[model samples]
Target: MIYLLSDLDFSLPLSNPVVVFSLVLFIILFAPILFNKIKVPHIIGLILAGMIVGPYGLNLLLRDSSIVLFGTVGLLYIMFTAGLEIDLEEFRKNRITSLVFGLFTFLLPIGLGSVAVYYVLNFSWPTAILVASMFATHTLLAYPIASKYGINRIRSVTLTIGGTIITDILALLVLAAVIGTTRGDIDATFWVQLAISTLVFGAIIFFVFPLIARWFFKKFEDAVSQYIFVLAMVFLGAFLAELAGLEHIIGAFLAGLALNRFIPHSSALMNRIEFVGNAFFIPFFLISVGMLIDFSVLFKGLGALKVAAVMTVLGVLTKYLAALLTQKTFRLSPLERGMIYGLSTARVGATLAIVLVGYNIIIGETPTGEPIRLLNEDVLNGTIIMILITCTISSFVVERTAQQLALQEENVPRDEGDSNERILISLAYPDTVTELIDFGMMLKPRHSNVPVYALNIISDESDNGKTKTIAKKMMDKAVHHAAATEQTILPLTRFDVNVSNGIIYTLKEQNITDLIIGLHRSANQHNFLGATADSILRHTSETIFIYKSVQPFNTLKRLVVVVTIKAELEPGFAHWFSKLTTIAKEAGLPIDFFATPETIKELQDQQAAQKAEVKISCHAFSNWDDFLIFSREVKKDDLLVIVSSRKDHVSYQPSLEKLPYYLSNYFGSNSFIMLYPQQVERGIKMDDVQFVDGSLAETISDSVAQVSKAGRLWKRLFRKV
Candidate 1:
């Protein structure tokens, strides 16, 4: 016991690294749980715990280099997550709203806060401006709350995230100009250098980074390696931003934007990103924030108290006024206005960086030889207290507002049709399981409760023991991969006379609505449709997808869909269209639909009715005889979706008979999906399905109604005779 206590001298700001880590881990684990029980947010708990454990409180732990490093990463993670999760379509639609809010948030805070600072604090022009600019900048500390509540895709959140980058950029610019003037480095050369470097940084992040990232993802399939690569890119952006005379947070955010298209929100990579950040780094940063406060300073003098009070009031007021003005300008709801205010009110990250820079710059000395800094100690302490208050307020407001928004959204009913969708994926090859599951997920609705069915059908003639073992292994791999993305899949293994019979029987038994099967490698030379695929297509009418992937879905540049004329008349047209749009949205890829003018009009009408937010480029091309005419336009990386039909379907054309040959000969190297929509006769009927306990009451009712109708027809015939 003495040996164990030997390392514990009860020293202030504990020096033992192992002890420090253990204490922090424990705090992280329990602080949030305890705080949540009392109706307080976990964010506040971590922060308040930091205050207790930090040098300013009980001095149980020091805010050392490791703490600062992790804290910085946490800040960057917050910004990065914000950029990654933004609904790009919403952002694009309200780009002007974001810009307007950005301008208002920045100008109001600086314009109003500067005057107040200059007069109330008796600060000079430069010092006042530098201090005021800090108010203009806000960290996205409360963004995680919005993300947690699944409101990140909402328009108000998108606008806040977009406006965050804008305000941070403007605030950093003011900091540079003020610092440059104070250093007597304000010149044309300075302005030119800043502009040129910023442009270069933007180019690298937007252009060069994505190219490299796409290549990296295509080259490597390991989830861990992919996650590491993302982190490296994030830091690279941060380093480049520093080189460009900007804050690292801006670079981190830009990196997220650049990589957003490649990393789907529902992908495993995204799950890992959010999990790691929220679990450890973000909490550490929140705690470090709490450690920054030294409340004792507020008691030493009335001047410090005055400055703290003024800064706190002005900071909160200015951000509120900006949000209020934006709300009025856009005619947004009160909840939306509160959301914006909560997100933007927190003064951290860039704000802290700016204040520290101000405090470090020495201008002159007093008669007593005390140094007169750009920002004095009183202001710094005041800023720290202000950070605590605003962060607390921000977290509480965002938590409450996000909860309300989530509840409100839940109250709004979703389409009941989507809730009943049951997707089935037939997995045979080990190489395609991950891609198949991911593709299936892309086609699934977010609000759907049905788990995807992954079926592995074994031939009855095969060695049952050996084949079952191999199938189980494959199913395990599928289940594990699906689990990584926070999705659950029900694995089914069935044995029948043949693979096709097994798949067909399972589909019928499971009442599957959609079937996704990987294109078998056995289809060589003459057989474009392998035996199993041909059999399933001929026997079943559910939406079937023969997916032959040559590249990862995330790496695909665009979705090139070849729609047959009158294809919209099929029973599965709406279902297949929804799936295509879902994939496009999930992968952040634009869609190019090649169809006749009439078909294009139908597609346009469907898109409008669904309100699907994806870029759809329509090209009128009715030359079915010349299928290769548009081959040159489709890039090597594009995923071609050929919307085909059954033999006697309304959209089936003679030219479609040679489609497999055309695809094999011309676009052989390209990744493609041969989609066969459900035919009219094979459409799912309520009376034909089996429910719980194999009940068939609906089917019995249908049979009785049909017999009654035949009896009425017989009576009418007798009367006529």
Candidate 2:
């Protein structure tokens, strides 16, 4: 062999960070090009390269320690970022989806994985746990894939993210319990201690951290949120992890989450962290895994071959099986189900890290907890073989499968729109509408079933006009808040003669439902804010949510509607109520309705001529005392809505501020949330509404079809991901 760097002995420098760092960079930079051309996985390429230069192959470097430290760092970064992105409120709202998928992904994989390890390969129970845990993780790569498929803003991502977190958490717990048992430390006290510690940590991070960070950012936005401060939080998380005998990665994740409210530059922070981790640190991690691989055992051992094959089948099959559980639960198509199956396939890095740690304890050449089967003379050889086989094979399967899906070569029918809980908000702002901008942001909350849109409508005069600058500033500001749970803001330049007409016209144009605004009374007392704002209230024919300047908006607590046995709601009562209930339930919100005696009787009367067929689990109440009582007990942030269709013109007797006067006073500091109801105008046909992953699927399909006649997954990975 040529002596490029082959003169170095493997035993001499196992922990040589510099050499490991140098080699991984070369491979990572080139792996995509080389692997894509060969139709194999780049991960495999890295592994092959690892074996060639490792102690087992050329003996160029020593194998005293492991490359997993590099992987651990990357894993920590990934986990922390994952935590930062998780929508907690949505998890509460869509707990059914989260709990189901989360549990499915957890159990399905372990069961299948154990069968592969024990039933097929006949490993010990401890080893089975290790194998099973690997299957439990879904790929973080799914984020990129979901983004590529244009479903990132939908419920699909929400379920996937929530499920993945639970999967990893359970995997860790299982690993802990198993490892404890393997090490003779298994006890009820140990499990109890573990549970208590996790709960305490989670509570502090969830409730306390958000409050503190919110306070810090509010009080000292600039001074308290420096880079040094970020570092301190990171250290705090990692140090706590150490003290608590938990993985430092958990600390990193929790730390990022706690500080999400405080970090005004979240996207920028992500970009910077990604730049360092991906461009600089991560390559070293990959290369280190590669450099220590053992080619001899990888090539020679049929046992290793069998394990890889067995695992591949189990891993893919388990996820597919998990997908099946949801088939009856939700009326999703097979393709949608399959897409989720593929989407949830988390990669092997984290799994490998934890397993290897356990493996080192009981016995192993590689990272499985049992007596070492491939150790002694060919330890490194065996390790390299497994890595090369597993990474390459799994990567190839996922990529090719996804590519086929993108191509439409598969016989599956295509669907329209994203039906999931994710929402994208495009906000429209007036030139001087700064008062309720914050309140406006609340209407387009990150945690809502529908994320609000902050759109500024421009006349599109100058390409570099003031509208463009303002729109960008507003978008940047909303993104900076981290308050948008499922929210996305897209601001653009469009022209209109008067701002209000422009606003109404634009509202109709964008396919968005909610319009959040601060109803500022005119200084001149002209009786209205904007003729269009006033007109929008009356004739807009859409749901208009009004925000305010007097109070900061809180998450909507109670949703109340006043109902009458009107002819408009005759046929569509159940359907309309069903829609409202789903939205509220999905948001984990409560809803209340005030009805007349006839209306309450109407709600209960099956023979009543219901128009919309709106089904609801909650009953209607006719008592005035009960309505007042409910209103009295309403949370300060509760939204009391009257389903009025026509816009409210100024009342001569009562001032604009005084309309819902008595009830508004009872609520104290909270702003009274007002919404002009949506009329069942122009009978809603089935095709009119796009339902699916936050409607992004249809949006993408529509946007693309409009732009071009035809498109497929031609270079789909590149196109989508």
Candidate 3:
């Protein structure tokens, strides 16, 4: 081992595959940490490290097959992840804006680029067109920065992402045309073939792949198998795209879209995919891009420098012009326009692909009968330099603009109405405490001052002290989880003979305006809200939310709210609506409101009157039975919310009791919440008596006698079982 260690020297060119792999891994692991300390973008650091070890610099590493393999994987991973992370609902809403930006960004750059290349560089028409197409393609290099700052859901960001898809596809198509024309294959048949093949490719990826994935996911329960299946789909999409005469990135992106609804962002499968890509594949691709840059060429003469400067200036200027036009047309703010420009300026994947394709094409012959290259070595090197410059500028600009946008949003007051709302989550199981806390945070108004309470109730059994200690540990875990999001949770522990009584005591003591409790399953396969959640729902006038999450809250793509008839008449309707809207905004999902015609009209009137921030689409449903049809459409990544009422209330119906049963049978794997809105007071009459079984009967019987003696005593005083 010592002899082998002595023989291994990384300073020199390392041919052993194992040694090369180790050295690259070391660079990947440490570059980000070292660069982060100095406040430099980790991506830039990875690129710089790649340049250092590349054949052009220290000659310690060469661009071998391994680099090519990993680099390609990284490129696909980047596109796939982009599709996976995009807000589809937002994308659909901003499709027109995306199309406008796409056309402007593509046309402006190509027109400007071709004219400049042809007139200034004196290149031929074919060569000029090919070179111009390079400027029309860009990579979302600064997307991570926007995402990190939590501004990814902003309209500008979504528009930019949507435009990226359009422009990249268009640019790559132009590349194909240019390549075919140069290769002397530009005939009617060529166009027809390309068109037909692209359609076929889209059908397979968008329609067929989803069908297969749905069946596979339904049948397969193993986590590892699901992950491998997703990976397979990505590769299959890429391969199919190549067959259709399009770039593989297009296929990978389509694959991501195909699988988006099936795999929730908060699922373990998605976490695994992102982890592998960010940890290894993406960094490798960035490094590979950096390895293409030959600094020596820039120092050689003014010609290369001139080309690099011209390309970089033209790229940035054209993107800026496009963004300016878009901003004016859409009446967007200056900061939003800047963000659009910054996100759309960086040239990488498609740019490199176009340049390389152009470089390989032979358009003419020199005087000596040698093939004349469409892209010369100087042009290639200059393009690489432009890539480095644009990427750096794009990252810096995006970071600054995103931060500004975030700060501006923070300062702007949201019109959620004034209310000191507090949500208390009753913890029964330690495993679900963190998830429950996250759900509460999602429902809470952004930047609000209201505190979140996490309560753990210990039963007054023989092992009370030991249970309290365990409860404290669980509460601490929940507190730690909340702290990560910069949220403070008030932890409360109580001992009572009945768990439900303890929860009710804390709810009253803390004056909680809202209650969140977990939903479990009973032996009969029905959703068991437990005696605790049931008692609170029946007795408390405060709004109550019962949540059962099968996956992470962030994974939700849509918030489906089922509003019963006359739901609008409830006193706490506005409060629960505000909470629902807050969850939608925080989760970056649109709200699909299913309600009766009357209720829908009322809701629309109220929304128009109050200028709410949430995007809602209303669907009419006659009654609760419509939920079965709706459930069929609810994907795995959706959050199902049912707004209910207490017994004998105007909106209360017998059918509401069957909702939990339906949800359990159909959507057991999906996350759902049931809310019971607060009601107005009606004088209680001793003559109007209703029988309820279990703990509710005992508590209510005690409450009736106490109520006769003392007018409306607190419900907790009757809990002496």
Candidate 4:
């Protein structure tokens, strides 16, 4: 009888499960840290460390079953997270191509792989099925890499990704069929049952789950925020799989579909879950895999190498060829096709799980004392070897090819727009509004030189005249406070608008490119921050920006631009920086443009919104004012914007000092100050600008006069209508 270690030993406790678990988990967790220095993939280090201390090599220790549990859970979490991250919207954007490429990718590989495995490799049907699965898989890792080069959304990246997903779906389906065939219990009679079950499962998960999960999330349960719902569904899915005699993964995948919409910030949740997996589960799982590796199976190492080579070559060729077929359908290029091939080659993780299922099915029914079968033995070693080689090759190829395929940043047209109008923006105490204002001005059309109206509404508590006086006072204070801190102002606009409707009404009435906002933003009044934030989050259609402050503004030298070329320029974004250039002529601060890699890559595509930000950024202030409003994104900046007009635009909180949305809700006036270029360039001194010298009360009276005139005109227009 085997006895557990009776006592503790001072010797290096390589045999201790706890020590083994701790060391291995940490090694896996920290593996990627070193890659920061060398610019290498963390995955490389992860696999290496897994093999080193694994049972076969050093056998440093054994992980407790609990840690092993973590690994299993990690696998499920990884799949779920993968499902969540899939850009369904993006997929829809290129649906025709996605479908065509997806189907083509699937068909080409299966056809090629099936023939290669059956005829060339002389494998049986089951064996061919297994082999084809590996060849017909893809991963999305290349998507991010493509993004690094600023080209992920280009036609090439889109086609490749679309094709890759198609291939992956095909692989999963084939994997399911193979597993079913290998299971002796699932005879032909079971085929009808399987088909029915699949249909039922998909319908319930896709059509029904959204309705149910939405209700559950409305309760605002904090625990559910951590995705206890997902966990519960996963557990139920596993249970149902056992009850229904189906693969647990199928159930998990279905549950993923069910929970997709309910999960908030799934990427954030995924990060935490992936951390748990990385630190413990996946490492142990990989290590356990290493422990199972045996070198004694073949004396002729050349045979093993030959097998590895065949598998590797087959894997690469089938995937690339499949992707190319997809490209043919979707019109992808050579580089994108190569990337799809590399991504599809990431089958080891998923493929291995399927393999393990097969192994268990073949071996589970045997006596506990019975030895593993020859097929299991041969397949295990071969599969492992193939996977190891495939993974390494795939990673290298993906990284290299993706790197070689750079994102083509597009030419930002010099500001060309309809009219040169400055803008006025207002906001409350320092927050995301600053980013909005900065970006608004940066991406605004330079022709009209849209000026921002930074308006701050102050309630002389001495007068409670409005119907919603308390709400108005609170909102006004919030806006005033943000601008009082100088978070967003007119330097980003050609003009400023601080009339009526507070900031919120002003924003709603006019076209604003982007609205940067903060939630739970506090005010001196009975601040229902949560309600205010939630209300804004739910009701607003503008591209709302929300950010946690990470850096402080020092010098306003650098500016970032994010304007979707297709988006109509809001009044704030309508004014090009030509007015600012006029202002800059006085201030003498040079403006430079910076765009994220995503933006850089988007330039190549003939898409319009992608061009707006860049064009807005690269143009002269005077010429940009006429450009139509498109979407707006945030950038970092230091200079105060000088815009041309703030007639209708509202809230200019561009500095990072205040929340953009907060100012829009409260201080509609103090959001931005108007400085018209027509006045400044035509010998109107800085002091001559009315806003430069006016007190808040004086400005409000003037604003009230303008508001009264506008109200009368609106009435006249309404009557005419």
lDDT of 2 by residue, 49-105 (tens): 655566666655544444555555655655555555544455455668867888998
Backbone Cα, N, C clashes tallied per candidate: 0, 56, 0, 125
Cα lDDT computed for each candidate against the true fold: 0.87, 0.52, 0.80, 0.47
TM-score of each: 0.93, 0.58, 0.81, 0.56
Scanning candidate 4 in windows of ten residues, the lowest lDDT window is 673-682
Task: After the best TM-score superposition of candidate 1, give how far the Cα of residue 65 lies from its true spot, in angstroms.
Answer: 0.8
- Candidate 1: regions farther than 4 A off: 1-10, 683-721
Off by over 4 Å in 2: 1-73, 80-143, 152-183, 205-350, 362-517, 521-545, 549-668, 671-673, 677-721
List where candidate 4 sits over 4 angstroms from the true fold. Answer: 1-18, 33-39, 63-68, 99-105, 119-122, 138-189, 221-227, 230-305, 360-376, 402-721
TM-score of 4: 0.56
lDDT of 3: 0.80
Task: Candidate 3: count the clashes.
Answer: 0
192 in model 3: Cα distance from truth in Å? 2.4
lDDT by residue for model 4 over 101-213, one digit each (tens)?
Answer: 67765676577777776776566777676666666665443333444454443555555555654556567667667766665556766767867876776676676665556
lDDT of 2 at 581: 45
TM-score of 3: 0.81
The candidates, ranked best first by lDDT, are 1, 3, 2, 4
Q: How many backbone clashes does candidate 4 have?
A: 125
